[model samples]
Target: MDNNIFGYDHNNTWVHQLTGTSKLLFFILVSIIAMISYDVRFITLVLILSLIILYQSQIKWSQVRLIVKLILIFACLNLITVYIFSPGHGAYLYGTQHIILHLGYFTLTKEQLFYELNLALKYLVTVPISLVFLITTNPSEFSSSLNHIGVSYRLSYAVSLALRYIPDVQRDYQEISMAQQARGYELSKKGKFMTRIKGVSQILIPLILSSLDKIQVISQAMELRRFGKNKKRTWYMARKFSRNDYLTIVLAILIVLLGVWFMKIDGGRFFNPFK
Candidate 1:
């Protein structure tokens, strides 16, 4: 398995040892809680816990640096866009405004900054868990785990195929790019931006044709095996829940409960430090 396929680390780690079902359940639960709540304190705690789990997974920074950079860039863009469009959104939410800096029509408020901070924390907390899950999970095992959790076997298999194909797509792109470069095609930094775009676009047609051919082959193979002919099927790669899986699930549930409790205590999702 290539470790670079969508940032998946093909290494042995404690996280990798856990059942795919458990990991998926944990991710789903955390994502739900993180997305639903707007409490800074709770989100910060989740961010810390997620980071700890990511660190414990023993995934190297180098493996995920590109993805992390992209996420950070998106986060910054989101923050800037939110502030630009709704500069007083935080004040509206918290019902108070303390101007930090005045800029004619756009005044920077502490409330807005804090709101954006929580929003950024939400991204920081959720994105790493998603990446870790992708990095640690085996596609076959993940599919089986999904089926174990009562998802339709067809859907599960589709998910598995998508995961399996990501690396193939990347490999195809690289091979095609190299082949083109060997033929004196310039798709490098030396090319002008539009020229590079046009050059890359040329790769897409061949890539798509190759992808379609591979898909047809795969479909034929699956058809020959009579895949999805039955409602239920056994999975050779499926894993059973272990004691650690139980513990991990329990901890995730506790965290969710704690988040809810925080929301109740704070009288809403926003933990207004200003008040």
Candidate 2:
């Protein structure tokens, strides 16, 4: 669990030391900004903020490469989809434009390319901000913040446990795969793709069995501790709101307000760059 993907490093940094509520608010505000505007300028502004937060978090790019690459792949797919299917047939709905390229089967329109760029920028804004929140904000901190914001302790704890279980499930799957391999069950196939496919199915039974066993253990532990007996509980990692926290919260609120303003300019939905 020490090297689990979702595990946090408790260091004293501007971003890390900020209250969890501040970070959550920031993430939500940025998400709204990302969702509300498809204009390249607006999306780029949001991405700049996201990049600043990413830098502040002090997380190594290498540590987050896999997730970043996955996001980029999705972004590229989105760009392709929007370019192919953008509404209004790419006739410079908002700006002057001309054809950029032409293929035998498809004509590349200026509006379509700009629309794709907007979609790509939207992913650049949202994904890094989301990754920052996921990597920097510990689950316990998040749960505690949620409790402070009037969530029931039971619900908060359940949410925390659900987050904790993601890495656990990943670890369990790996362990089960190794155990099966040691017992001469082949999961890494050498030849036919179908054989590899069939080999992978061997892992499911053990993984499910181990997950069930883990759930049982957790349930028994909760029962022993009389988990639901108290309507209130104390958190070991509760956050105290400080001046910096207040400032961050204010910034988040401002960002959300700005998003609302932009949404109004967009007529209450995404600002389509093509229009």
Candidate 3:
């Protein structure tokens, strides 16, 4: 198996050794904890726990750079949206005496500021948890684990195929691009924005054609193997859970319980100033 950013690492370790199903269960459990509330403390704790898992996965931080960049962009976009769409309640929450800064006759208030702050914190809690899962979990392991949980092996393999294809698709695109350039296409860095857009548009047709060809080849290969003919199929990457897996699950469940308890006590979502 060629190891890409999303592929499973085969070298024996605590994370690598865990059964695919157990890891999927753990991922879902953590995601539920992360999404169920916008409470600062709970989210913070979940984020911390997720970070610990990421560290334990043993995949280098450099390997997760793409996911990290995406998370940063998402977090920033969330903050911007909250700041702009924040309900105008500035004076009521922030205790700022009504001295409004006129923005061309429209005044901004302190309540909005507080609301934005709350929203920012909510993103801080949610985004990291998501990023941690995306970076730490191996896609092939995730799929095999899902199958172990009684999902159809066909479906699980489809999921695995999608993960496995990302890098292949990227590589294919690069190859196609170079081929296009060789044939008098000016798609290099020197092109204007519109020109580059047009150049990319030209690339898309060939990319789509190549992708369809690849899919056909894969389908034919699967047909030859008589896939889905059996109720269950053995997986190359699947295994049973171990003691470490059980311990990880138990700890995650405990954290979720604590998060639920806190939400019950301290009012759930901190994204609004009125809350």
Q: How would you encode candidate 2's per-residue C-alpha lDDT over 1-275 as one tens digit per residue?
A: 34545445565678888877778877877787677676566667778888888887888765576677887888788666766565434555545456677653357767766666666677678877787777777889888888888889889888888877877777777787778778776666554687656656877787888889998999899999999897888999886789988898788777777767877787754455544
Pairs that collide, model 2: none
Separately for all candidates shown, the number of backbone clashes (residues 3 or more apart, or on different chains) is 1, 0, 5
- The residue-level lDDT of candidate 2 at 184 comes to 72
For residue 64, model 1's alpha carbon misses the true position, in angstroms, by 2.4
Residues 1-275 of candidate 1 have per-residue lDDT tens digits of: 24444644567778998988999999999999998899988888888888888898888776677788999999999999999999999999999999999885579999999999888888888987897898899898899988888899899999999988887898788889888989888889987899778889999999999999999999999999999898899998887789999998998899899999999999988889889
- In terms of lDDT, the poorest run of 10 residues in model 2 is 1-10
- The regions of model 2 sitting more than 4 angstroms off are 1-4, 83-97, 101-106, 180-199, 260-275
Q: What is the C-alpha RMSD of each candidate to the true structure, in Å?
A: 1.9, 3.6, 4.2
Instruction: Give me the candidate number with maximum TM-score.
Output: 1
Pairs of colliding residues, candidate 3: 20-145, 21-145, 89-111, 90-110, 90-111
TM-score, cand. 3? 0.76
Give me the displacement of residue 34 in model 3, in angstroms.
1.5
The TM-score between candidate 1 and the true structure equals: 0.93
Q: On a 0 to 100 scale, what is the lDDT of residue 162 in model 2?
A: 84
lDDT of 1: 0.88
lDDT of each: 0.88, 0.74, 0.66
* Candidates sorted by TM-score, best first: 1, 2, 3
